[model samples]
Target: MLHSKSILSFVLVLFISGCSSVVLPIDERALINDIKAKYQGEILAPEDLKKGDITTYSFPPVWGFNVRSYFSRDGSFSLDREFYRFKNEDRGSTIFEHFIESEGDIEKTGRQIILKNRIAYRKYDSSSDLNYLSTFKECEFKLGTCTYKSASGKDKKVKTYFENGVWTSEYEGFRNSKLIETKIYHKSGLLIFSSYKGLIRGNTSYSNREAFEANSL
Candidate 1:
């Protein structure tokens, strides 16, 4: 699963960028508590669920500086990520550093939860085989925010909440925006799930969040 993330990051290094949105800073602890309080239905314990009783579960992100949560369920995880873009004279789409903001991910498998966020900046070169230059920054949660070291030597922080097992995030991509992609996920118990990614925002998002393993933090 991590490999897929790596491959995606690698490919985006070849793209360019645009303008971004205003993302506020968030507290990880406060955010987790809010999720637990709001989406209690999806996190049913064994004692709470009888045999044949259909139940779903998804945990809130734990304390500390991580965006990932733990454990399993019948709930789903929906993610909306942004990548910067640039258009060339030939009408080719590229991602450049000066464009704006990009990066984010949230996923759960078995009992492990992982949070991934990276801002990739590429320098466009039309005459070169590799049209873009490689420059990237992976942000980590700290002090209630995701801190990123920008290409200009400035520290930037961006925060998006993962509530009720749904992650709806926005990125202000390229100055002249054309398209944006978003992914919706539906996970059944035992990790069986379906995902759809597209340019238009999805309306299939559900807010049924839960945690199956009662004691599994």
Candidate 2:
């Protein structure tokens, strides 16, 4: 028994709500600089990086794994997969490498350094497989936000933003071209709430002390 005007108004309200939920991309380099500024002294030295480990728990239906990250004195880092095994031990096994500020004009702000370009290479087998390379443009201390060009030359844009104590990062570049977003709400550098959507979906929250306990480092 709704009138025509009432139906039109309802449709308009739904349209506005949909628009509000859309995530707009931001400046890639600016976002990386912001993250580096916030975590200036947290960068790991070569010796200190060897001592720490990062363990991430995947929700049910997804297998979990441990990550051992090694940082070099030259501002480069590589992540090795702890569980992956290969018949030929000599074959490359590194998941990815982040070469920060090693190729171009290095820019320094105080003791902190901002990386302009980074190159990441996936696991390669010299006996058979071709080395997959993804070139990163405008990278910061770590892999915060940047443009990634795949081996095939397709570009994928990534950006992270903070609002109301929650940091959200969106990556738009999978095979299906779906937007994958992750939101992390933290306190005192510990995760309080974390959620993932678009492709992989899960939501988890924790208390301050619980967050610290969850960290394996």
Candidate 3:
């Protein structure tokens, strides 16, 4: 049940994955590793870019890959202006992800993923739309943390972990902050997985500490 756009994406991924000289091979692990090496520090000023810092990084591809940095120094990524935000290269620019520290507190422990569909998935399907000018649906997380859900029927809360610039068990789904019925991943700098909810519809294997691949979902 892949959408037309999703199908096209699949084909493109196949093409890139099949290419031998594509540098990073259309997968998540390589991209995550690249991102981890680049921004893993603290933010000194408004323009300072640090690893884990929520700054925008542009890539040299047609479907440009972008990043919004974060780290343990800044605390966590959130929907607030001072936390995190990101964008994709739909306007012929490589400015894919953007981040900023807001004046709010993140009380959870999962990663905030800013997706191309402009959705933020926290845990349990808590997806929401981005505001475009100041608040988009996509974002990034460094060692950042946020509020998440635990297993409960009426009232339950649990702390997800976002340390070392990666979400240990967070899964990105649609526009809901609720964890999807599907599995998610820190796939790459620009991609994520909806495996847990049966989106990919294939059995996958982990790649590095970030990405994964499956022949069936």
Candidate 4:
């Protein structure tokens, strides 16, 4: 009876361990692809656009915007294409005054409105806690532990030992109350890399890593 109990207990321990978040080293290329897939995509402009000035595309689990504009036979916008302001108060006399610098036409690629007020923005449903701004003012170089709240309000803590602005080692999701996420930044405050590990619906669990390079706009 004692031997049987020991075997059963060992099996139970293994099962529970398998169900938990797993952190592993990642490849650079794989990390970049995941970052682009998760973050690089359509972004909305005129964030404060009124409900009426714009038309919304609504679908379960997704939403997008389409401002009314005139088009030519070639599918290019014509001179008739005009946009309205939120109200009679024109902060300044300008229509799409913001410049969108991209290799291709931003409107066609669905990546319009680059560098709002000079700060780059990426689209990720605004759901993932992996936002670019979220990591700001949180910590700095050297060795220490920092705690943050996950999208689901769970305590996510990351401990890092850094040398020369590089994360050498990390203790991610150190406890049950912790969700694992890691971030690295260049000296310029640009996000360089990130990783997240947590549980999801349908018994799915994953550890995702992302690496970002500064893109000139």
Best by TM-score: 4
Could you give the candidate ranking by TM-score, starting with the highest?
A: 4, 2, 3, 1
State each candidate's clash count: 27, 0, 49, 0
Report, for every candidate in turn, its global Cα lDDT versus the true structure: 0.25, 0.28, 0.28, 0.30
The Cα error of candidate 3 at residue 178, in Å, is 14
Model 1, range 1-217, lDDT digits (tens) per residue?
1001101111111112123231112232343344445434533233322454432223222211111221113223332322211122112222221221124332221121111111112333333333112121343111133656656776644443433443333333233232222111222122111111112131111221222221212
TM-score attained by model 2: 0.26
> Which parts of model 3 have CA positions greater than 4 angstroms off?
1-53, 60-156, 162-165, 170-217
Best lDDT among the predictions, by candidate number: 4
Q: Each model's TM-score?
A: 0.20, 0.26, 0.24, 0.31
Distance from true position, residue 72, model 4, in Å?
A: 44
lDDT of 2: 0.28
Which residue ranges in model 1 land beyond 4 Å of their true spot?
Answer: 1-147, 150-157, 176-217
Candidate 2 C-alpha RMSD relative to the actual structure: 19.7
lDDT of 3 by residue, 16-119 (tens): 21112112113444444544554334212212213443334433222211222212133232112212223244432223232232343323223343433222
For model 1, where is the 10-residue window of minimal lDDT?
Answer: 1-10
